[model samples]
Every structure is written in C-alpha cells, then in structure tokens.
Target: MTSLWHRRRQPDDVPTPVAVAVSDFCRRAKAAATPTEVREALALLADEDDFRVRSLTDTEPERSPLGPFAVVDILRGTAPELASQRQGCGYYEVVRELARVREEKAPPAPAPTGLTFAAPPAAPSPSSETPPEGSTARAGKSARQAAETLQSRIAPRRREPLAETEPYEAEESVSFKRALPKPRGRFTQVAAPKASYQTLLHVEGKGILESALAQNEHRFALLKSLSEQYNGAKGELGLPDLEGALQRHELMDRLTSRERQGLLAAYTEQRGAAGRVAWSLGLSPSELQRLVSMLQLQAEVEGVRERFQREALGTRHLTQRLDLLGRDKYLADLGIKKRFTEMLRKEMEDLARGELPDAVDLPGLCLAIARKHGAPQELVLRALERLGLSEGLRKQLLAHSNHSSP
Candidate 1:
C-alpha cells in the first residue's frame, strides 16, 4: 500500500451539475475547428441560468484546464472581434445567439410610407418665350440705365496717381562695439580635482558603504548596536517563536529577488541548518522542501546544473531524506503493514551508519523508534534483520525479544 505521505490530495468540493455540463461544453469547444462552432457549443448553454456556469467562463486556465476563457483564447486567433466581444461580456455569446434566434422568428419590418409631392412648375425657357410688343425696347433701355449707374458709382472712387515724389535716400550706417571688462589684478587658482576618492571595494560594496555613511554618524552607531542586539535576540529564540516572529513581520514578502537568492545561499552554507534557515526566512519546513524540489525540477527541465552547487544539491537531498523521517507521527498512524515495512527499511538504512549504544536495550530502542514513527515493532525488527543490522546488536535484540516474550 502507498503511504499517506505519497498520496495526492483530492479537492474538497464536488463539482455541481451545471459546472460539469459547462466543463463538458468547454471540452467540446476546445476540439471545435472554428469560433462559430465553439460559439454554437456555447449557445447550448444560453438558457442555463445557473451562476456556476457563468463563473466557469472566467475561471483561470490553470484551475479549469478546458474553461471557457481558454476556449475563447483559442478562438481569438481566428475570430478576434468575436473573441473580444465575448470577453468583454460573459453572457455576450449567449445573448447574441438568443438575439439571432429572436430576429429569425420575428415578423419583417413594415414598408416605409410612400407619400408623393408635386414638382414645382418648370421656369419658362428664354428661347421658348415670345417677347411682348416693344418688350425688346424696354429691356434695352433697362440695360442702358444699369450701365450708366455702374459708371457713376465708379467715377468718384478713381483718383489720378501722385504727380511727383521725393527721391530715395539711404540712412548713414553707425557701428558700436562691446567694451570688455577689466581683469582683476589677482587670479584664483582652480583646485586640483581632489584625487577621486580611491577605494578597493566593487561598485555594489561601495554603494553599501556609502549608504551606511550617508546616515547621521550617531544614528549609524546606534544602528550597529541595534543590529547586534537583534542578532542576540534571534539566536535566543526557539524555532517556533522565531518562526512566529518572522510571520508577524511578513519578512518573506519584504525580501527582494536578490535577497531571496542570498537567503538560498545562506541555506546552502550549512547542511544541518536547512530547517533553521527555512524558519528564519518565514518558511515552513514543508514549504522549504517544496521549494527545493521545484529548484531541482527547474534545473532538470532547463538542462542547467551549474545554477545549484554540488554542496547545495547534497544538502537539499539530505534535507529531503531527513524530512521523511521528521514527518508528523500522525501521518503513519494508519499503520498499514506494507507502508510500515517500507518505512522500517528506510529507518534501518539511516541507522546503519551510526553507532549503537551497548548500554541500551536494542529491541526496546528499535521498538521505540518504530512506535514514534507509528510503525509496528515486528516490521522494524524484520527490516533490521534483512538489512544486516550489526551481528552483536542483532543477537542482543533477539535475546531481549525472547526474554521479554515470556
């Protein structure tokens, strides 16, 4: 049987009927060849008034693998406008389909009113009209009168050009020059550019030093004192208290990418302090373990091994193995025989490299360790025997067992 530790967690909530139907529709939409087909599939759910169906439309692709949002993204390439419109309104696709159906079933619009108006009588053409008797003489007289009036209006406005004008004369040119200021009797010497403050530190190191110095001198000294005090206080704190303090301060969220990398470096510095480093960074041991696994997986996927040092890798692996042994005792409380046997094998291997105390009762020690890990004593002993426990320890354990069996 697989250990509880190895089993994946199942989601707590069962999917509703509407959500299941919507999910099925999304799957079909994903397989669709075009946006129209996808829309057609969605149209089936237009009348589904259940709110869960609508909620699924906006769910993230990661949470709902074949969600409506994902299907819309797939349709976007082929039908950008439709995709955009649908995205703007969750019910757009459904409303549009309903509107289209309504339009198809509705009666045709009434024809526009056809009221007509009479055209005005056409003006009589000049060529088609016959002049009245002496009408030509009257028209000629009117033309003569208009010409005379136009000449009268122009006569008063016209004036003869000036008879004479003064001859042009150029003005005499005048020049002025700017006067230069008198130089002072004494000259000021430019000081030699104060030998560019040389330093052995790199740019980053120099910046840090400069920042520290930028503070008030007294404040800088006080800061140093406070840092010392803080370090002492941190060292005195128990693991749980330290973790709580870090959580209260939200220190992990405050750390920058560079600071996080530095923290990782610190974690790798000491193999045994992995748990301590994790807690100091406001991470639970499980979170730290997951982070390590993620890093390893990322390195494998990217085909890059240099990112993590050999020491770091060794530390992480050791931390993971130690973590297995350090799991909550309740995880093994089910006491499955096969799982206990497997755990016993691992525990025996772990113990093989260490010294066994002559003063201790071997059977009792084994039993205690197994019970602490929620494993059966029989399985632990059998595993120890199979994995070659030291001959002397094995004989002592067996004798103790026989003696106690009564």
Candidate 2:
C-alpha cells in the first residue's frame, strides 16, 4: 500500500550530489521565462534520476505548457530534499503564477469518457497499471496487424498472379521442362551455385583425406603381417621374445678359422670346375697330366716317411729282445747279426748315394745299432766319430754319448 512517490524515494532517500544538481536545475527552470529555456535547463539535469523530466518534455510534448511547475510537482512528491530546496528558492510562487496563467487561458473541460490519464510512469501501482479488460484483445490484434504490415514491407505483393498455362505452346511438345509457377504465401529459399574453385577444393580435400586414411590402413596391415611372421618363426625356433633380441639375431657371426682356410683351399684348387669334375673325372689332357704327377710325388714322399718310422720301431724292438736274451744266442738262433750288418750297410750306402732328404742323424742311427747288438753306446759313438761323419755329426754324437752313459 506504499505510495509510488514514497517507494521511489525510499531507496534513494539519502541526499546525493545529483540530487543537489537536480535541485539547482529545478530552481533555474522555474525562474526561466520561455519554454525553450525551461527545456534546455531540464535537459541539463541528471538523466538517471530525472528521466521523468526528459520524458515529460520530449516524449509528451503536450505537457510543455505546464512548464517547470509540473517538474516541481514531480520532485516535491518524489524527493523531500530537492523539494525543500526548491521551496526555499520560491518554487511554490512560480507554480502558483503558472497555474494562474493556465487557468486564465484554459479551455472548457470535456465530459469524462470513462478514461483516465495514464499515471506518470514512476514505480507503477497495480491498480493504475492494469489495462482495461478489453484492451488486451485489442493490443493483440494491433500487434498482428503491425507484423503483417512489416511483412508486406519486406516482400511487396506481386502485381499479377502467374498464369496456369504456358504463354506459348510448342507444336510438338518439346522434351525440355518448363519453369514452375511461383508458390503462394511465404517466400521460398533458393540455393546458390558454388564457385568452381571452391567445389574443386572441397572435392580435393575429401580425396586427400580418404587417400591418407587408406595408406595408413595399408601400412598398419603390412606391419601386422610382418609381426605375425616374426612371431611364428620365433615360436618355431623356441626363441624367447626378449626385448632387443631381434637386433642381436640380425648380426650374424663370420666364418671360423678352419672353415676360412678350407674355403680358401677349395676356391684356389677347384676354381669354377668343381661341378664338371664331380659329374665326370674326364679332364683335359694338361689337367690330367698335372694330377698324375702330383699323385706320384705324394706317394713316394709318404712311402719314405713310413719306412723311416718302421725302421725306428723295429730297431727299438730288437734292442728290447737283445736285453731279454743274450746277443750271441739271439744272433745264432735267427742269424740276426748278418741281417743287422746288411741293413746297416744298405742305409750307409743310401746316405753315400744322397738318397735321403737331408743329412741323416748318424749318432742316433749308431746308438740304435749299439742297442740292437747289446754293445756300449760310447763304443758305438767313438766308432761313428772315427768314420768322419762331418764335424757337426761328431759334435752331435759326443753330446749323445754323454747323455746316454746313464
């Protein structure tokens, strides 16, 4: 039930600099002689707190004749401080003069039309704010009319409706389609054709994206296949899938020393003819002759070595037998003395004939003879030394005699 004036003043009750300025403006406006001066003064007042002043002057020009007296009425009712200030400046005197002049020039009052002037728009009261019962329907009709007016402005009515039939009929009814008639009511949206470059750019972008996706998928499949193959091989070999083992397996070891030597020998001797040689031993004349010569030389050298080993073994065996049995009895039993002398004579003849590979170890040969005959090693060495088997051989026998004395 609070009055609008009280309600508006309640929040802004405390005096402010704007209020003081407003009070000054109101005093000046009241003293102003002409409506022009009054309007200019009101325009200078604070817009936020004095919006009613501007509204009364600008929006409702019909109320300008009331002058600053109307403004004083509004301020007095709404704000007590500004009102008190205006009163001190003889604000009431100005209002009275204006009222007197207005009454002198006033027209006769018209009969009430069951209508009231709208209350000046401050904080609104419910009773005064409600429109009459029928006004809502009238407002809705006005709004619809206004919307239609706007729509008509945007799209003007066509001068003539489209004809039902085509303007010119073709004699043979051409295959090409005719344009369709315009639709009634709301405007239809038309699609615009895109530029060639824009269309190409979009198509190219889509193609590139699809191509990249396909390539990515192919690469993924390849990697997956390789991974499966590797894992299958590892399982077959019973190898652990340890980290970094793939790199270690890739680093293969080189051929060993014996394998390298055998490979070199095979390469040197066989060259490119190994396959032909294996298929048939039928060789060219030069190759065949060289092969026979090499075989003969190898056989002769091997035979000599074998004979030398057999002689040494036989001499040792004879020595052991002579030790077991007296030499004369052994020699008489088998005539070994004559056989031993003949063998020694043959060996000496071979050396004199230069049939041996190198100078023979005469001391070693003589020692073997001495052992076979059951004679002292020193007696054998002294006999070999007197036989003049070179100075080197003499020195060798002397060392051997001393070593074997035990």
Candidate 3:
C-alpha cells in the first residue's frame, strides 16, 4: 500500500520547505538499520520548528498528511528482513512526547471581547417642586406631549363586549362510537446477549479438560503443555519429546476438536516464539509454523468480516438519514463494499457502461477509492486486473502503477 503521505501528493504540486525536510527525515528513518539510527532520524524531525512538527502530529487520523501508520512504516524501515527487529511503537511514544512538549510551550490564547451596550439614560424622578418656569420647564412639557402622542398612535384599540345571547338546545342527543379494545399478547421479544470471547474460551477450556481425561497419557500431557502455553508460560517445561511423539500412531491421529481450537487460542495468546508452542504441542517446528499461518489467515478473515459489518451498519444509517431529508440521491452512487472484490467489480462495471468520463484519471480514481474504502491500492489493482477491463484503460492503469511504484 502507498503511504498516506505519498497518496496526498500531486505531481504538479511543489513541496514546501517543511515538507521537504520532513520527507528527508522519513527517508532517513526508513533507511535506519538500528534503534540508534531511528532515534537520530526522530531527533532531526523533532529539531524542526516546534509549531510545524506539532501541526503535522496534531492532524486528525482521517485527514492527516502524515498519519501514524505512515510514521510506523518509516520506523519499521523498508527491509523485510529487519521488520521483525523494529519497534514501531517507539515512534508513537516519541510523537506523544512531542505533543507534551508542544502543549507546555504553547502560549495561552487571547480572551474574546465581550459585547457591551450603552446604558439607557436614567428616568427623572417626579419632583414635588415645579421646575423654574423658563426654558427647562417648556422643554420638559414639549417632550411629555410628544411621548403621549406617539403612545396614542401605536396603542391597540379596545373592542366593546358583545351582548349575551341565549344558548341553543339540541333537538336530538348526539352519540360517539366506542373505541375497540387493543389486541392482547403484543409483547416485544428481547434478543439474547452474545457471549463474550473470554466466556467462550472458559467454556471451551472446561470441555477440553473433560475430553482430555479420557485420552491417552501422552495426549493428555500434550494438552497440559498447550494449556500452559496458551496461558502464557515463557520457558519450556519438561514434557514428552516432540519428534518421537508425532511418530506414534495414537498421537498421529488427526487433531481432536480441542487440540485444533487450543492451538489457535494458544497462538493468539502466546507472546513468545513459535518454537515454544511447537515444543508444547509435540509437533515439528514446520508443522506448528504452518498452523500459525492458517490461524493468521483465519484472523484476517474475521477482521474483514467485522469491518464489513461496521461499514454495512454505517451505510444503512447514512442512507436512512439522507432519505428522511429527501436527499437519498446523494447516496445513489455511494455504497459500502460488502465483499473484498465488490468495490473493484463495481468500478469495472461503471467503466464498462461508460458511466465514468473518458478522460478520468485512472490512478487518482483508484487511490481515492482505496482511501475512501480503506483498501490497499495493490489489492484494488489486482482485483481490477482479475475482473478484466478495456485494453486502453488497462494499459493506462498499468502505466500509472509503474510510474507510482517505489
């Protein structure tokens, strides 16, 4: 996937001094081979104007120019061999520290000016003594006369009360039909709460304990080691030899339900090496590795499932809100991808039907779709290719891909 930083850049756009410096820092960070080198690159970035660094770090994730994921990737470096050795978490720690520094160094904002109004002139109190009968008294008399005239003009006119009339008597009695009684047994049914992962694990563990008791001694010991591993034991415990144990016919039988599930649970919980797990489960290292891969694949599928569910709910909510406002057409072209291939398939169909303009920028469109839908560009490209497209469009996409390749 292209980093968000690269995705945000346009071919014609010129890099600002700050952008150029930050880009250099990111390049250096990616080239770092050791923790010390990573720290040095971070220091260089931090040495920039505090406000500039703070602005970049303070940007919200969704619209951020340099996001946490991009920062972590830089910290992890470009080398696949060194990926396992890198500590991407440290980059976030540094960002947090920078944030603290920025907060401490920042000046307080100026207070807002409050609205003020001139007080109305105080009304003169009535005086017992009459004012000296010259200009002041004449002016006061004129003002009073003008005020009375204005009040009389704006005041509402009073209406005279109408004379009382005799009430009429109904010739026949009026009747209202009685309302029907509501139907009974209209109670709503509440759904059962879903079981939590920990609760499910506890139930599974109890079941495993019961079934393991009937298994052979060797198999039971294997289960015990697996349980310990799942619970996060670090060093190896004294147990059956992994190599010879696998050769035994009874042990060689396809993994029981508990065994397969326990392996997955252990793999997820264990923080140590796969070797520890292999030793615990009485399986060869290679077999355990393969199982781990399968578990990872399963986890990815489960994650995708959860993401789709969330997207579906969000899309539905947005559609309902838009419909209520009589603007559902705003969402006519907007949709959530229900499956991994759905987004690319939709785009391909749109292209085939000439729904998209002929001059549409293929690369920009793909990047936008990937970013909006939270899919990797590589996956988007792969799906597009698999689904097929016109020769010209395909060539244009391929050329863009080559030009953008790092």
- TM-score-based ranking, best first? 3, 1, 2
Q: What digit string (tens of lDDT, one per residue) describes model 2 on residues 176-223?
A: 788888875567665443223222134343443233334422222222
Tens-place lDDT per residue, model 3, 18-109, is: 33344433443342222222232233333333355435434422211232234434334433223222334354345445544554465655
Off by over 4 Å in 1: 1-33, 37-102, 114-121, 130-406
Cα deviation of 115 in candidate 1 (Å)? 5.1
Predicted structure 3, TM vs. truth: 0.23
TM-score per candidate = 0.19, 0.12, 0.23
Candidate 3 achieves a global lDDT of 0.41
Off by over 4 Å in 3: 1-40, 45-261, 264-354, 367-391, 394-406
Global lDDT of each model?
0.41, 0.39, 0.41
Q: Could you tell me the lDDT of residue 19 within candidate 3?
A: 38
C-alpha lDDT (0 to 100) for residue 390 of candidate 3: 42
Model 2: residues with Cα > 4 Å off, grouped in runs:
1-326, 348-406
Instruction: Quote the positional error of residue 396 for candidate 2 in Å.
Output: 15
